[model samples]
Target: MTYALTNMRRVLRELRQERPADVPARLWRYAKPKLDVLGEEVLYRARLMGPLAARYRGPGIALMFHEIQSNVDDELRTGCSAGHLRQVIHAVRAAGRDIVTPDEALRRLGDRQSAPFALLTFDDAYADNRLNALPVLQELDVPMTLFVPTGMITREIDAWWLVLRAALRSRSEIALPPMERTFQCPDLASKTAALRQITAWVGTDQARAESLSETLGPLVSDPASLVARYAMDAKDLTQFAQHPLVTIGAHTKTHRFLSQLSDGEVLAEFTSNKNYLEALLGQPVEVLAYPYGTPGACGEREARLAREAGFKAAFTTRPGHLFPDHLKTPHLLPRIDIGYTPQRRSALFSRLSGFQRAMTTRWGAPVAVLD
Candidate 1:
């Protein structure tokens, strides 16, 4: 029992330190999250789950979203419908919670006396966020944290995902001579599979541009053009960046997976993007959401780099509710991704509950070493 306890502590420590994992650490990372989610669901079914009561009150949640638009005519789908976004906000309000900015949410971690709240954060700065999500937020009268990729807005980074997605939809077959694999995308399911496989192999947006160009030829032409079409530009954000409803956070410059980069490269990605966004927006960009916020894509090393680069907080796409302990490791914060969930109260409530967050995360909250 003592041995198991020590191993569990070590797994959490590795999450904090980003060291190469042992088998136990690997299992904890992959298994624990699933177990947590299952536990929450099981408890709910058993009627053992309660409301957002005192046990779950101090630190609430940070909801993650991308492309909250509805353009049926457009090939690339929104992560969820704009109407669903309205429902989410309504549900949160019905549960008697406040939706706050990122700063407020992080502040609540330390101020246990603060009210129960949730933070809405949109990643990738999709143009639809402005056109679709923003209006809905306006009608609802709440704020959002927008994580922007400075390079993509500046046309310095290719909106490679947009290009690749379009390519997948238009082309019936995709041939990769280098990998010696040809994907037959005859329908939506096959096309989605092909896109996923290609994206997994392509890895980062930085590498995807080069890999797709080399293997697929001009199949993905002018990623900048795709950016202009799908993503919000610097000019579009010029007005919105200063708005009261929006809080702009850095989403790195090129959207590369920072965990895969060296210390120097990681710092460069954070610092350069921070400097860029600060200069462009004329506001102190104090927070970040690590690009590809997974254990493999971003861990403790990346979070430390973010802190060293002078960000007040950095977020990951890990599942969990915030807790006062998060104050100890501000940069390694976890957020719940609200992907394509239907406009059902049950679905929203399942995600909103503290029991769920507790179960869905490997560790309930981030652990930090005392000085």
Candidate 2:
């Protein structure tokens, strides 16, 4: 669900039509609380485990991570802090469980699995992962997969979200052309409404790109020119991949929402990244993670593309544990999100006690089959 937020503009647009008057603040308030409550419940459940049992473990679990930076202040933007990453590693280690590599996990899975296992994964290839997260993983000798969007390898901050957030923060009454409307509000209200309306534009990749350029072009410091930045260069990736503890996967070329694209475009996005990563690593990159990893982000069609592209496995942002039945479709695996928020505790707990599966079946039924 949180992964789907890459398309914030699309969500806000829906809210605008449903509640034209007060969509932004209302949506923000409404959305985070539900997330928070779910988190709390998940954590409480996790803490209830009696003692770690090695033999009775269920299925192998994969945890998804985003940015992990030194100063925890900007943690909100990245979905996690260095402290959180450390804590998560510590928790998994203290439990005396094993941290399995993607290949090891799959091999064991092919053999009908052993005990419960875990694979730590990072998404959206951020520079901070090298500086903050990678060191921790290295020190602990943990195996992890870092999924990159390829486009961000030589780019600065994630350009799309930077623009979307700025537009949401602006109090200036601006007319959004694509929606064929101008938002009018006295103060923050208008800004929030604008955010709500604009989010809906993320329904399609082209719409997402255009809407971002339109809303953030004026606000971003230097929108006219493309700035060269390093998320993780070929050298960084090569060093990590050679570490024997790190694996790399393709996260598409442009980070566009896959569900919004046509079959041909989806194939291009999936295969291009796979080919790029394989070339960079000098190995067969058989795994893929959907951009955004949401129902609206990449649906059945996109899953087929990943399979057709010869990817052995594909991951989604849906929170839950993996079961043998889950192996039916290698292109659709359930991954638990380990975000920066305190709710991570909840998420971990939910996974341990099976609350995540329960909640996913109840509230997230659409993707239950995918899981």
State which candidate has the highest TM-score. Answer: 1
Flag regions of model 1 displaced more than 4 Å. Answer: 1-58, 76-78, 177-180, 200-210, 221-223, 341-347, 355-371
Q: Residue 306 CA error for candidate 2 (Å)? A: 1.4
Clashes of 2: 13
| lDDT accuracy of residue 283 in candidate 1 | 91
In model 1, the clashing pairs are 36-359
Number of clashing residue pairs in every model? 1, 13
- The CA lDDT at 338 in model 2 is 72
- Model 1 lDDT-worst window of ten: 362-371
* lDDT (Cα, tens digit) per residue for candidate 2, span 114-217: 76577899987767777888778878888889887777764633456546544544435556666677665334434444555566566545565666677667
